[model samples]
Target chain A: MALSLAQASDVVDAALLKARELGLRPLVITVLDPGGHPVVIKREDGAGILRPQISHAKAWGCLGTGSGGAAGARHATRDPAFFAALAAISEGRIASSRGGALIRDKEGNLIGSIGVSGDRPENDEAVAVAGVESADLVADVG
Target chain B: MALSLAQASDVVDAALLKARELGLRPLVITVLDPGGHPVVIKREDGAGILRPQISHAKAWGCLGTGSGGAAGARHATRDPAFFAALAAISEGRIASSRGGALIRDKEGNLIGSIGVSGDRPENDEAVAVAGVESADLVADVG
Candidate 1:
């Protein structure tokens, strides 16, 4: 099943609420369907300008690696050069880092990913987790 | 929705007026929304052929930094490696230094950014700021 625009908007809106609840900085959030196309992308007031692209890369990286950004982070640690080359191969789509999580249906089928940026890495991750869960989808922060 | 086309066009026109008033070189200007998509772009007659790309890069850089071009310039001067890597991450959409400003609403919500080229960095930035202000928007050069 594909992620709907309405669902994606809800995820982003919920993420913004969570970020506000946590007193974190304003954020940029993006949802990508399994096909690696963006379902929705939004930036909050005062969020960094590069946040949209950065968030896209984070979520896309999750899809490409088939794990929430965790797998990519591991690859970055285990083989720095190889991980560095990943960006070039992906044409700058992969940014192996935190703040990204996989979304899955009740049956555990991959839905896509939620990405948040504009704060500490862990804070960004927390917001993404909140977003995915808010949509009643499983969040694989892994 | 992103910044409206009419507003973007107004920004461009005002920037052009400012450039002429200051006796600056024929310039090119560009506006980009949060999604890093162009809203408007215009080049004055006799402007350098590269002005379009250069101005777009400057405005895009402002968005990438989550600030006006000034912060990016500071980053470039203080940390060339990090800035270079950032440029790579943004796929050359960023050109740090000047000629760009963040546009915000009265509530300080970032609407987009404007960029000007074909003059000295400060002069170009002034033109950009003037353009943003003409729309009754805040021009954040920081």
Candidate 2:
């Protein structure tokens, strides 16, 4: 089944709560459907001005590359020029970072993704994983 | 005060409710803060794949020109060249259409904007206005 709006909102809400509990900086969280369309986005009051855009790019990158944001970062590490060209082609919507995690169904099919921004890259990824798990979905962070 | 995330989501919720009440087609609704950053976006099931991007562009255009989408359309009509240049300069982020409306606070200061897509432009504008008003904000649609 496609990711429901209610599920997306739940993921974002859970992620934000996790961020607060961890004492991370204010965050921006975004959830995209399998087709790379945004379903929900939440920007905390004190988040950096660019956090929303960054979180969106991270999730878009996950959808575009069929990989988690951490995997994208690894790919970029090995091929900076190619990643840069990809970013240019996507109009800067792809971010090779660690805050994006792919969402999958029980059958192991890609469904959507969650992206979080505000803290260190690893911390962001951890929060995204927590959010995805909270929704009882698989997080394809690898 | 700036547009809060709660307020933005409320706008999207109200807009979608209106769309349903009007028997309009599935829609994509987007809200952008005054700085042109996305605060909330919701794409209904069956909405066209491009609706989110189109809605985002509409709202961004409204913020960029400090005018509602209808006014942007009028400006485009009067000076197509200038509008075209603007689209090019903004890397296709601006769309001069009739589905975007500026949001203002009680004091009449610009707060953000809402954009709706997936129907006739005028109908989209009507729905957006309904949403902004539902949130107790001004809808600058003139």
The 0-to-1 C-alpha lDDT of every candidate, in the order given, reads 0.83, 0.89
- The ten-residue window of minimal lDDT in model 2 chain A covers A1-10
- Tell me the tens digit of each residue's lDDT in model 1 across A34-90: 989999998887676678878888898889888887666666667766766777788
Instruction: Score residue A4 of candidate 2 by CA lDDT.
Output: 82
Docking class of 1: incorrect
TM-score of chain B of each: 0.94, 0.97
lDDT string for model 1 (B1-142, tens) is 4568998899899989988898999999999887678999989999999889889888888877577788778767865533543565688788888888878888887788888899999999999989988988888888
Per-residue lDDT tens digits for candidate 2, residues A43-89, read 87768889988999999899998988888999999999999899899
Model 2 lDDT at residue B32? 89
Fraction of the true interface contacts (Cα pairs closer than 8 Å across chains) found in each model: 0.33, 0.63
Q: Against the hidden reference, what TM-scores do the models get?
A: 0.64, 0.89
Chain A TM-score of model 2 versus the true structure?
0.96
TM-score of chain B of 2: 0.97
TM-score of candidate 1 against the unseen true structure: 0.64
